[model samples]
Target: MGMITWNCTEVEEFILLGLTRRPGMQIVLFVIFLISYVISLKGNVLIIFISRISPRLHTPMYFFLSNLSFLDIWYTSSIVPKMLINLLSFKKSISFHGCFTQLFIHLCLGGSECYLLLAMAYDRYVAICSPLHYTTIMHSSLCIKMASGCWIGGLINSLIHTLFALRLSFCGPNVINHFFCEVPSVLELSCTDASLNKTIIFFCAMLVVMGPFFLIIITYGYIINSILKINTSVGRKKAFSTCASHITVVTLFYGTIIFMYMRPGDIHVANQDKMATLFYSVVTPMLNPLIYTLRNKEVKGVLLEITRKRHVP
Candidate 1:
């Protein structure tokens, strides 16, 4: 495909054509997203707080859960506040630096979560499949190293993408189609060829998204096999319960992500893209804390005990 040569000028700012153009709808969206953002923040914060204060919850599993909650808090924060502002604002413009900064942070946190989930899956795998050596294998030093590696890996991945995106020239029509600056949406406006960007995106998606995802699947396969070997029904149920929440969360998160990134570039639809991004970016974070806590007896018990103490006083 030949590059479309537009008048070459530096794009200093970008107009984010947000989720909706209708005035009435923007207000409604603002209200809805504000509530969602607040809930996501509070819920994730509560999980972090509960994990820290309760000694019973201090294990490899809860340790990873707390990391996940922390990541979710920043993941939602990186996008939602700007989205809420855009929903309420008439202009809906973001500076060029700001847009790419959003892109970097979003990708960093997102990539981090992918690896964190993989780490969590590995934790579950060790706990279930190697019950005898679980504590020794997932020791504190090892867990910390794994968590740090996830963050550092994500940072490196985001930095590469952001640097390449910055190099792309946006000479004209500096309008982003989506509510927030994302790889696909921003690439659409590039005056220069974005084939390389797309290629990098595909390559990185394999490394940061699909790679961990497939490993998780393999890890869970072993976990299921181990669960099946347990003699008693009650033992099997207990084993399955430990995994249920993580499976649900993985499905919900990775489903949207695969749809968004893994599909062919030619199959672009603005509305579908927006909705998919909204589900993963905004809605999933809000649901994660609920998924973890509601399904977890230990977390629930701790919450109940904390509530009872306040009520007694």
Candidate 2:
């Protein structure tokens, strides 16, 4: 069923050396991460609900956004709750199967988010650059296809990396120097030579992370150019407003990912990686809903109407 050698010395579990080691800080960290997890779930779920029920948001952009919110839920849910429990309890160990499951889910959702954002950038490009053809180019069928492609692309990417990781053997000193079972952290504990794994990770990082990032940058380039051509100040401001939230989210999301993964495997600083993961995993998901709701006037109006309607009856 698989290419990996399963008989290599059995590693039953892994100890996660969470964000901090100071005994006093564990409680503090627990509270903080617990609150973050709660907010992340609430915010992303509300975004999905509002995006679905608001007829005003029944467009390509909101469709992509709802997908994004859904991914965010899976993304944060994969790691944060376990992390919270670890912080509170003395048992910081996770079963070998559980670790890999977390790895697959996080990577699948994270990679999906990357491609989903790419789709969003293209949506903006079409809406702004070729307004007349927007509806025709990004029809219902096409949107579904693009979104489906993102999820499938992510699944394939995760599957490749997961299999690659499984091929290596993890032996003693089975302590991962982070809050969760990330690829790099787990790979550090491998007893066998992992040069191939490192190389593949670097290539995948470039292809999945940088590849979409550059695409997003190029798309925004055309979008900005199109906005500049508008004669009126109001027109330019409105156009800028449309894509501004996306740019902000992109910067926040990619800034952490690029920093975390685009490095020589040996040079990774554990504490720094933990903090970066924290931002991307917890903070970014929570902020996405806030960013879209607060910054976008249309969503805010819809949210208000929803609130008002509930009170009216």
Candidate 3:
């Protein structure tokens, strides 16, 4: 009992055993992640800016896209800067409070994103399935409510898990074998029996991640059926094109998350987990804005107009 108690001294900080130990690799990774982070911030901010100024993009789709941009900005910012710093610095330590804060914010943004994707899917469904009732159903008030619900649900879900995690006794061996603080990564260091913590993670994930994912699948199922019903081949192609960007983004985001979190902690191969975390946290945010804006004619047209206006001077 004495030895056990001695081993269970409350941890003050944690060392993040980041992606690589090789000095050369660290430098290369730092440069790559830095560029990716800058591009992600710039791209998402531009999306928000264009969404605000462009009257043509004042519809529900762009509105949700703007929310997604805002979320991606906040989400990536929560994880990447710290990761970049850790990659360059010799001391890869984060304080206890900082870890919790990161965990809370990361979960909040991720959970909200899941629901936001569902909302976007529903918007697509309305646009395609019941075109006549689209405006009536997705009015300003309802859109605001749906967006608010996504954020609020995410916050509530994060708060629940964070509060419970705080109750556990984190004893010794405080090196986290991942880039940033995540639920499963942190739980690995707990001196207490972390079965409960793992259970909460699984349950919350099912609700926050899997639940929205299944909804998106169902919504898209309806959407694809509707697209199939279109008589003209051109009409069907156009409809599929409208959805292609979104489908790509969804697949990218959900695929990484499900692969990372849905499995048991024991099976999470260390290097693989680190790379997967990088993909979702760093890579996905950068890709999202590029995917949406590059594929979207309305966004391109607005950007071109902005460029033209600047050149006019």
Candidate 4:
């Protein structure tokens, strides 16, 4: 065991070859990403604030939306700040510990969002299908429990991946092609046989990504069925409107994720992978609050009310 371990000189740090090396392109990318980061922060914070202050927005739907917005804040934060710093810096590097910590946090939040979306879908299902018992079924206590479970599940999933990553030995050639420390990119740098890591990643992707996705699909099927059953066209339209935002979010998020992780190994391209990661990691979080607020009338009315009150004073 000692002799085997001695064969590898473990690297203490990694050189991140961020999004671009061209000086002009770096500046352009920095400005774009910086603006995106600011927007993401402001939008998600506003969602959380409005959800808390407005009594009309105190339902299970908004409750989950607030949780989702909070998750987006940290999710984008975990990678974007470090990425932005590296964009402008000459020697773009991250310590071994820092890289892994980012990986753990990124995965934790991503996994958590999957279940949170599922919870939101379930909320819609309850509201549309079983309208009379919606309040009783999705009570405050149950909502809290579901939200807590999503976090706990993500924590465990991230722990498993992080622990498996820790077992690998990195010898030399510590340059990571991506801006952030994702599991796939890090695994490529490992000197040891990483077949186990690949296997585990695929296995967990099925559980964490595909599992919730399929469940969401099934839940929506029931929701649609119930909505169609309503005799009035106006009622059906109203029911569909409530789910539009969530469906859009799910499509954007899950499409990129599946394209990134679920495909065959032969088709993988580094640049394509990077772009997909950017969309889901950076772009999706920024768009979430906009999607929710623009599609949601109640949230818009509350925002208008707050704006008018502030101006009156």
In terms of TM-score, the best-performing candidate is 2
What are the C-alpha RMSDs, in order, of all predicted structures? 2.9, 1.7, 3.2, 2.1
Report the number of backbone clashes for model 4.
0
lDDT of each: 0.92, 0.91, 0.91, 0.92
User: Model 4 compared with the native: what TM-score?
Assistant: 0.96
Model 4, residue 268: distance off in Å is 2.0
> Across residues 1-313, which tens digit of lDDT does each residue of candidate 1 receive?
4753333448888999988899999999999999999999999999999999999988989899999999999999999998888888878999988998999999999999899999999999999999999989999999999999999989999998888877778887999999999989999999888888898998999999999999999999999999999999999999999999999999999999988999777787998899999999999999999999899999999999999999995
Worst 10 residues of 4 by lDDT: 1-10
Error of 3 at 80 (Å): 1.1
* Residue 208 shift from truth in candidate 3, angstroms: 1.1
Q: How many pairs collide in each candidate, listed in order?
A: 0, 0, 0, 0
Runs of candidate 4 exceeding 4 Å displacement: 1-9
lDDT of 2: 0.91
By TM-score, the candidates rank as: 2, 4, 1, 3
> What TM-score fits each model?
0.96, 0.97, 0.96, 0.96
Error of 2 at 166 (Å): 0.7
Off by over 4 Å in 2: 1-7
Candidate 1 regions exceeding 4 Å error are 1-9
**lDDT tens digits, residue span 8-74, model 2:** 7478999999988887899988888788878878888888898888888899999999999999998
Model 3, span 1-313: residue lDDT tens: 3322213348999999988899999999999989999999999999999999989999999999999999999999999899989988999999999999999999999999999999999999999999999999999999999999999999998998788778778878999998999888888888778787788888888998899999999999999999999999999999988899999999999999999888975788888888887888889999999999889888999999999999996
